[model samples]
Every structure is written in structure tokens, then in C-alpha cells.
Target: MSVVVLDGSTVRSFVADEAAFSRSVDARFAALDTNGDGVLSRAELRRALESFRLLDGGGFGSTEPPPVPSEVAALYDSVFEQFDADHSGAVDHAEFRDEMRRIMLAVADGLGSQPLQVAVDDQGGSFLLEAAEHEEAMIAARVRKESKKEADGK
Candidate 1:
């Protein structure tokens, strides 16, 4: 895990970079499509969500026991419904991308402009990680530009 300082603008900036955003999202989608079918079945998505422990509110870093099985099932269904845009049984790449974009934007809106120090899994290809990496790259570029300017002046 790594701690990164980020604000809404940082996430928004990452999302605004279409190429980077699409690549990150696509990579995640591909990973979730475990069957190599070019889409995610309900089972595939459910398994991924369950493995991440994202199906229950209490599952995330909480010492509380998991929610009832039915409750978790319903929550999983709701999330799947959000991703399955056309009432289809599966989530195609476009649907997955659109839903992910919406979710990330919602997170950014909730975060607003307040910078927060968040602990994120360094190995995960999560949106927060992408945003943090983006911010770091921008900072590095600025530093390199400044150094070049100073050297040229000398």
C-alpha cells in the first residue's frame, strides 16, 4: 500500500486524459473478463467484486462481520445492473467503461477540492492509483522542465 495526496481535480485531470483513462479502464475490464470472452458475465463480475470485498459496505477495512448473504446478493445485483447498460446478461467493454467513468466521476465529486491522504493498493489498477500516478508524472515533468531551463540559462 502507498499513501498519496489527491483532490477532486487530480481525479478529474486523470479522467480528462482520454487515452490514459481508457487504457486504465480497459486493462481493468480485461482483467475482469476472466473467460477471454471479451465481455464480463454476471458470475465473472460477481467473483471479481467478491474477491475485492466490494459487495458489502461493512467489508471494506471494517472489523464488522459481513452483511447478510441476501443483502450482499442484492447489492451485487444492483452493481451488475448498473454495469449492464442494455439489460443484457453481460457487460460489454463499452458498458463497463461508461459505468466506470460514472463511478469515478462520482467519487471525484464526493471528494470535491479537499486534498486527502489515501492509502491505496500499489498493485491494483484502481482509478485512485491512476490519478496519483498521473499527478506524480506531472510533477516530475515540471521538475525536469525547470532543471532544463536553469541549465540552459547557465
Candidate 2:
């Protein structure tokens, strides 16, 4: 059976491509499309942000504030703007899928020679899964430490 080795970014790509992930993203977009107009204007986007804050236990009057990092928020805004092509302030399913495909291809290319493949055999799947699991643990640890530092005012 052909075996494929995947780098950390490739694993992230696969995770993003998962059907469950796609459905979750689609649901979020649908929810953000306020007014039933099938479009998400800037005001709708702002409402979505507020909704997220509320969902995450950070209400409008809460002093705790939201936990999203500045870099992450910037990234989200950039992506949202990019997807809202034509300046119409909305992204249909086609646009969303196109953007997602663009992002996936870019991530895959950045992974270099570490091509993430679907193996034909069980052994190959197991090997790749184990490697990805280890890498995920390492990434999680690093993220946790960084988050702690950010919380500590460091």
C-alpha cells in the first residue's frame, strides 16, 4: 500500500476538510446571514461577533472581555473581508467554498514535500494517525503555554 507522510499544516488542512467541519462552518455562515436576505452585511458581521462573544460567556456588559487574541481577530477580519467579494458584504456558498479551497491549496503547498495522502492500507493510516496525534499534542501544549502568558499580562 502507498503510504503518505503529512506535516503539521497538512493535518490541519485535513481537519479543515473534514465533512463535520464544513457543516459547522456552513451553519455558522447561515446564522450570520441575518435579515433572511441571504447576505451578510458589515452590520450582520458585527452582530455575529457580538453573538460569538455572548456564546462564549462574554456579554455586552461583562468586564471579563472576550478571549480572542488580537492576531487571531485580525486574521478573522482579513478572511471575512476577502470572502466578501464585490464589496457586497456577503459570501454565498460558492464563494465560501472557493475561498476555502484556495486556503486549503495554499496550506497544502506550504507543507512542502510532506504530501498528506489517504492510504490504501490500515497500517499506513495507523502510522500517519499516530504521527499526527503526536504533533497535535505538541501544538496544543505550545498554545496553552502561550495563552497562559497572555493571560498573565506577560
Best-fitting candidate, scored by TM-score? 1
Q: Estimate each model's TM-score.
A: 0.88, 0.37
Assess the local accuracy of residue 93 in candidate 1 as a C-alpha lDDT between 0 and 100.
95
lDDT of 1 at 59: 55
Model 1 has an lDDT value of 0.89
Tens digit of per-residue lDDT, candidate 2, span 54-77: 335357687875566775567557
Location of the lowest summed lDDT over 10 successive residues in candidate 1: 51-60
TM-score of 1: 0.88
Tens-digit lDDT string for candidate 1 (22-69): 999999998898889999999999988887866455655888876789
Clashing pairs in 2: none
Error of 2 at 119 (Å): 30
Model 2: worst 10 consecutive residues (lDDT sum): 120-129
List clashing residue pairs in candidate 1: none
What lDDT does each candidate get? 0.89, 0.59
* True-vs-predicted CA distance for residue 34, candidate 2, Å: 2.7
| Cα lDDT over the full model 2 | 0.59
